[model samples]
Target chain A: MKNIFTIIKKEFSRFFKDKRMVITVLLPGLLIFAVYSLMGTVFSGMESVDENYKPKAYIVAAPQNLEETFSSILEITEKPSLEEAKKAVTEGELDIVVVFPSDFSQTIGTATPPDVKIFYNSAERNSVYGYTFVTAVLGQINTSAFTVNAASDKFDLATGRDITGNLMSTIMPMLMFALLASGCIAVAPESIAGEKERGTMATMLITPIRRVELALGKIISLTCFALLSGISSFLGVILSLPKLMGGMVGAEAAAFYSVGDYFMVLAIIISVVLVIISAFSVVSAYAKSVKEAGSLISPLMILVIVLGMATMFFAGNVPHVAIYIVPLLGSGLAMSSIMSFSVNPLGFALSIISNLVITAAFVVLLAFMFKSEKIMFKK
Target chain B: MTEILKVENLKKSFNLSRKQQKLEKTYQKVKVAVNDLTFSAYKGEIFGLLGPNGAGKTTTLRMLATLIKPDGGNAFIDGKSIINEENEVRRKIGFLTSELKLEDFFTPNYLFGFFSELYGVDKTTAAQRRQVLFSKFGIDKFAEVKFGNLSTGMKQKVSLVISIVHDPELIIFDEPTNGLDVLTAKVVTDFLEELRAEGKTIILSTHIFSLVEKLCDRVGIIINGQLIALDTLENLTKEKNLEDTFFELYEKTTGDRI
Candidate 1:
């Protein structure tokens, strides 16, 4: 027991002494924080743009009292012809153009209504902005029309906005899986395969300690580092969340996650990290060198990225069995469930069991490798 | 002097498959690494297993060190069977080979501490023994330097230090001075002599006949995995020098056999 502890201590000391290990462990965390923080700043700044700007609108074939109705909200441009207005919209000179057909208000007063063309260039940013402004004015006009027909009911607009915020929170699970895969790939390969390439492995083996003890020590240390990296990545996603949401909606609607949900999401992420680390440790032990290990584990990163994107795009509850058995994907589904406050206790329990079983299998494989002289001394 | 280590009809063979055999064209045959080798080392004697490169010297040492298993036969260290009680045999012997390299990241002092703990030596006793060994071997001066940054001679000395950190009853060294400078080699040879004088059993494998002639109380010559000769230096050197006697024995075994 003392011998094993001594070996573990020696191994850790050797790892901490290397500058490469330090950089490998910390650089990903730092990079994620820096990148996300910068994105957050950009997105937040864009979110702060004022909503009251009366963008210029070109009108052709003006309806009766239409000028009076829109005068308070829109900055009217020159009364151009239909063709000229279309050209203006295309040339970026007009924010939007409203064309009233020949029988505009006459048809509206009767049963037959003429079509009103709201022409805006979808390719231009300013044109989209003008179209959005006009849509808001149109919405208010429709609301007044409804009020004139019947008494208005008390309807909270904030509740509708919060629903959109809930939908966006669904992407959190995929982000967590991405974090786990990235962090594990960076640390696990180097811990075992790198030691072999650097010729430190043989020295480690000749010590009086058993192979299982060494494997456990390495796995525990690497899992801790990987989990730290996962946390940093989760932080990155969190830091960027408000900006991403605020850009799509208002600041009030963007703060979707509660303190409880954040902790639950973090727990799910840690579980995913353990699964990735255990799987990668086995891969690392199988590889003859660090380069080979890196190559072997690279596909895992791609899988995470693809799965994360898929989860983000596809919303709703996952099947119970899949939520438990599918390694990183299971944790991802659980994370999304947590963010949406739709926790399934059965799925969570099964997921923990499955991950623990897989981890134990990896540990057993590593122990077996350590005991095999052929494997340990393979050229 | 009492017998500390004994090898009885020890043999080890590894399977060698020809390219055609690997393709399922023929059956693989066993190639012997150590064949029916037998020798013994008494306490206070420096025993040398002399052989050329590719001889079974390393295989023999590995078996005795319990790092590898012999195919047929057994070895005993301090009356403990290597085949039955490996850990006990390991505890009684300190083994080193030229192929085994030290980790460059650690200082000699740190490595010493690590091995001492591994050998189950008490802290104070380990420290005291470390200090004495470091000074006696003159490795104390550069004990703090990383093994990688040290010169070849210094690294070799550190390797020796870590091997005997627990001060086992019997010490086994495989080509201990292969890569060392003359001065370092002399220091190592002198140190081995001192260990022998202190009534410690020492086993060394070397290709250098002169060193064996000077230091070894008994010598065993192995060729093609078989021990061809085993006797005291004087007995093996009947009427010729050690070098001539080695070649004469080599010719007799390998001449018509190949």
Candidate 2:
């Protein structure tokens, strides 16, 4: 155990003692924050409310009651015929066209709900935005009219909290998983294969310490550093989240998570990092040089990306407990579960256990690789 | 004198690449690095394994160091088997080679302490040993300098100091002075002598006969993965000078005169 600590100390000093290494470890998180914040700013600008630029709408048989509400956000022109309005929309002169039945206002109190038709080119940006604005105004009118006239209690309006929750579950898991993976990839290769490439590993092998101890020391230290980088990048994303989400559908999604939620996130991140470090250590041990290590570990990056993307659909809907035991897949599911605030501790426990087991297996494999002269002393 | 190290028919073989076999125009797949090798070193003596390049000196030393497993036979260090009790064997020996390197990111002082801890040397003893070795090697002057920035001589000195941080009973050096300048080589040779005088057992491998002649109390000449000769300097030099005698042995073994 002391020998393992000694190795850890050496590995840590290898990175922390050098200013350039420290920068490399820290730079990714800061860059993520900066880039995400900038993206949010640009997207927010794109989605800014343009009070002066109203959508040009042509309406037929326009209802006097709802016309005032629609005209507030749209430049309305009464059309005599639906063909003229349809042509205007297709020709791109009109952003949207609304068609109403001749008895639309009178049939509102009837058993049948009147049909309202809206037409716009989906591909045109102006038409899309105009369609969105007109629907929002119409939705408000429908809600008000239904509340006053209808005797139903099943009216469902999604609250900001629900919208934010959906956004958090859908996106946060993928981002967190990707950030953790990138952080581990950044340093694990250099810690193990870099030493081998530099010939320092041979010197280490000649020491009195057990080979397994050396493996443990390296994996532990690498895990610590990788976790640090992963968390830093995660925080970078979290801190800039508001900016990135500005003008997004659920801009207030940041408020959906509590302090306890973040702790769960950290726990999941650390567990996942252990498995990453161990796997990377084996890859590093197999590589002859740092450059080769990088090349060999590139496929693992693609795997991480795939796992991260997998979390998108799995978020808030993780299946069986068995699924949480499949290494990266489980961790991704666990991460999605945590962000969604629907985490089953038992499932997370399974993920943590499975990852730890994988890490241990990989560590043992690394020790065996260290013991193999063919691998350790390969030219 | 008590023998602290022993080798009994130690053997190691490696699979050759298809390209190498084609280049050699041989269908042989396995290249025997060391074959049925047998020798021993005693306490308080410098025993040298002399060999040309690719003659399996490094492989033999590496096996003895327990860095690689032997395919056949076994060796013992201080009565501990290299095969079964590798960690015990490791504790009893200090192995160094030209192929080993210290991390350039670390300073000599830092590495000394680090290795000392790995060897389980207590803090006070490690510090005392560090002071003695550092002063002796002139490493004290640049103790804080990162190893990468140090001169080759300085790096070699630091490596030498660190390799024996535990004061192990037996020390193995593979071409210790292979790439050193004259002054550094002298320092290394002198240090080996000093260790010998302190009653430490030393085994080294080298292709240079002069180094064997000057430092080794007894020398073993390995050629083509086999020990062709082993004798004291006096006995080996009885009939001819060391160089002529080496060539005579080589010619007898390979039917090639050089």
Candidate 3:
């Protein structure tokens, strides 16, 4: 046990003591935050229009009742020629062209009303807005209609907590798995296979500890580093998610999840991380070098990514409890349940237990591989 | 003198991959690395296992170091079986080879402490021993330097000290002077003599004839995975030099010339 601690300390000293390794671990998270925040801001910028600016449109044969609607939200102007207005609208200079028949509002009571053509470029944000306002105003002509959901208040009955839960449930499970898998990939190969590649493993092998102790040491230490890395990345994704959602979600999303829920999520994440790191360690032991280990682990990472995406497709409560014992995919399913506020206690318990059992099996296999001379000494 | 190590019919062979077989231009599927080898060394003298590369000297050291296992037989280090009591055997011996390397990211000072702890050395004794060994190899000045940043000779000195971090009774060093400068080589040769004087058994494996003559009390000559000769340096080289003696035995065994 002391020897295991000794090896753990050595691995930590190797990772945290070096500036390059710290950067390699933390930089991805920092970069993710920076890039995602910038993307959210850029997307908002490209998709929004100024409230004070009204969209300008050309009226070919302007209906007189439409004048009131244009005064508030639309700038309807008379053009010299319809051809010129179409050109301006196509060229993105004009917002839209509402070509109406003369006295079109008077003929609206007829069973077959003449069509009022509202042409606008869907690509332009303001133009799309302008087109919607004009169509609504025309639709109101010659009818005493009750407005459907016309009040300025928010109409959806779902609370802020529901919105947050829905958003997180849709995205968080995939993000968590991918980020944690990345963390495992970043550290496991370097710690295990890099030692083999650089010939440092044999140095540790000559020590008096059983190879199992060394295996335990490496997995535990790497789990710590990978957890650190995963948390950093997870923070980046979580903190930026509100903005990425175009202000649909924010810090309030965290409030929806109770401390118990958070602890459960953390537990699941740890289980997932253990499974990932242990599996990677086994592959790394079989591989001859860090590069070869990476090659060997790529397929597993892909499998993890696919399992993560599975959480996205599994909406609402997972119907069957069997999915909670499928290792990586199971943890992901449990995490999604937590995010969405539908925690199945039995499934959650099963998932965590299943992951831990798999991790132990993987560690045993890794230790056995460590004892193989050909695996350890192969060229 | 009391015997510190014993070997009996130790054998190891490897399955050659198709690519490896093609490279060696041989159709044989298995290549024997260490074959039915046996030898012994006493508690307080230097014994040299002299062989050209691929004659299984390093493989034998690896087996005793518990880095790998022997296929057919077992060895005892101070009566601890290499196969059964591997951890105990590991505690009783120190192994040094090019195949075992210190982490480049670590300074010699850190690696010494790290490996010392792994060897279960007490902190006070480890610190005191570190002081002595570091100063002995002039590693005291470069103790804080990373292993990669150190010169090859300094790296070698640090590796040597790290191998003996627990002050084991038996030290096995393979090709200690194979790539050293004259100064570092002299330091290593001098350290071996010093350890022997302190009553530590040392097994030195090398191909250099002069190194065997200078430091070894007795020598085991190996060729083609078998022990071809065993004698004192004086007995083996009484009439002819060690190299001429090795070639004559090599010719007599497999009828081959280097």
Supply DockQ values for each candidate.
0.40, 0.74, 0.70
TM-score winner among the candidates?
3
TM-score against native, each model: 0.76, 0.83, 0.84
Instruction: Give a tens-digit lDDT track for model 1, residues B1-258.
Output: 699999999999876657635654547576678999998999999999998876889989988887677889999999999888777887788887766677888899998898888778899999998999899778889999888899989988888888888788899999998888999999999999999988999999999988898899899999989999899988988788888888888889889432
Model 2 misplacement above 4 A: A41-160, A247-255, B22-25
Off by over 4 Å in 1: A37-171, A246-267, A300-314, B16-30, B256-258
Each candidate's root-mean-square deviation in Å?
10.5, 9.4, 10.3
- By TM-score, the better pick of 1 and 2 is 2
lDDT of 2 by residue, B1-258 (tens): 999989999999988898989876889999999999999899999998987788899999999988889999999999999999988988899988878888888899999999888888999999999999999999999999999999989988999999999999999999899789999999999999999999999998988888988999998999989999999988999989888888899899889867
lDDT, model 1, position B121 = 87
In candidate 2, the residue pairs with backbone N, CA or C atoms under 3 Å apart (3 or more residues apart, or in different chains) clash, namely: none
Instruction: Give the per-residue lDDT digits (tens) of candidate 2, residues A149-217.
Output: 133321112233443454456666567667766777778778888888888888888777888999999
Clashing pairs in 3: none
Question: Model 3's DockQ?
Answer: 0.70
**Poorest 10 consecutive residues by lDDT, candidate 1 chain A:** A147-156
Report how far residue B20 has shifted in candidate 3, in Å. Answer: 2.7
